[model samples]
Target: MSSNIRIIRICQQCGNEFEARKTTSKTCSDNCAKKAYKARQRSTNVQTSAEQTLQIKLKPIEDIKAQEFLTVNESAMLIRISRRSLYRLNERGELPFVKLNRRTVIRRSDIDRLFDRPAELMEKSRPEPVALADCYTMKEIREKYDISEKALYELIHRHEIPKQYSSIYAYVPKYRIDQLLSNPSNLS
Candidate 1:
């Protein structure tokens, strides 16, 4: 059940004439086939790279910048913020927007005006370090409260007791430990 039909084709890679039984044949030898496959892979990769460059990175910035008003998604993309955060800003009335026929439109000028007069932020000063003499070591806390070192650490961690480490020794303010452990209700 074989028809004696021979198809003549040119190698897609090296331009050599070849005889094949199938019309889909493109290359004369295995070497030509490998070369053709590599060329096609390279072409596909170059095309994919070009498509990514054209669509994802460069084109959006140009299109977004050209518009006077932007949607929530476009505004978030332009500012490099999350859509949820932008929506929260709108909810807080921090970022103003206009509604036109059920469309949430943010003006470009409004977005630019956000940093016009930046709020004066003040930094809080750190508290003075507690003197090591005024604090109780882990051994002292354990001896005074009749508790194990492990239990002392767990208590300090659970109550967020400000314990400072100095080299090999850890210290907790005597007053803080006294206030925390002195409370009978805390034990309950």
Candidate 2:
């Protein structure tokens, strides 16, 4: 006995014509409200399921396990490195590989060995530089040292880094950068 007045209105929950007892009434009955709520939950669940399926399909390539032999592309994907890097490794005789017809295949064992090696050992295995002076550019030194242009200029002025001027570009000596990199504590 909430009210005797019958206000004609549409049930918002079910989109049907119904007589509402009050002006603020949305659904014709409590059952229709519950039905609408259940429908919303079902739609949300379906959307979530579709999103999860898409995520699964776009998962990172590193999740794949290594096999006995892998193509150049597959090896790059598994290692999470560029194919050009793998090709360079193969060219330098650093990473042993096999040629199967026209395709280049890398052994899983070799990839494992490469991954398992210590970073220091791996770095040492690379070819020696032609000269220490040719190591880093001015921009590289600034970035690696995390110093501003003004600070870099100050350092260059104080340390007197033997720079080679080429039109608008100035190249910093690699030995000086190597010194700072090797002894980060020396930077003031």
Candidate 3:
């Protein structure tokens, strides 16, 4: 009878038991090593996917915080207006803004207030005190005179109306509008 022997080996790649022909064998075979490599790659892919999802979930919170206090550029983007137009409004005292160092800042609340009503309605809703004051918001101007935006701007451009700066809006002094209205020649 011929003598028989068996050798057991542990696959270096997968840690599974297998038969090996050589005492020096480490992996079960090249196939097992490749399978183990593929499994590791799959595990890495899952981990990367989970990390990506986590990042995506946190983006909105970060965006909100970023917008909480905004620079001129951010404010312009939020309002869907150009920076140049915003600057014009600032110069004309039509928008509320704060100056910090060399930068111009706008409050999120003020921007929110801008969209709260039609310009006409807002102009009309101001308290009598505000109406009589030196400055008013665009909305207030629209409401008080019952005029279109184009007409208001035309009045401002023609010096037919005098304006003052408040924290918001080019304030059309009620006195000036009254003076102009009293003089029908001022109407274009």
- Candidate achieving the largest lDDT: 1
Q: Model 1 segments beyond 4 Å from truth? A: 1-58, 121-188
Question: Clashing residue pairs in candidate 3, if any?
Answer: 119-139, 123-139, 123-140, 135-171, 136-171
RMSD of each: 13.9, 15.5, 16.3
Give the TM-score (vs. native) of candidate 3: 0.33
Please state the error at residue 92 of candidate 1 in Å: 1.5
Each prediction's TM-score versus the true structure: 0.34, 0.36, 0.33
- Per-residue CA lDDT of model 3 for 52-117, tens digit only, reads 877754545447446656777667666668988887765444566776897778878777766777
How accurate locally, in lDDT, is each candidate? 0.75, 0.71, 0.67
lDDT of 2 by residue, 36-58 (tens): 78988999999999998787547
Clashing residue pairs for model 1: none
Instruction: Judging by TM-score against the true structure, name the best candidate.
Output: 2
Model 2 weakest lDDT span, ten residues long: 126-135
Model 3, position 39: C-alpha lDDT score = 82
Q: Model 3, 117: alpha-carbon shift in Å?
A: 2.4
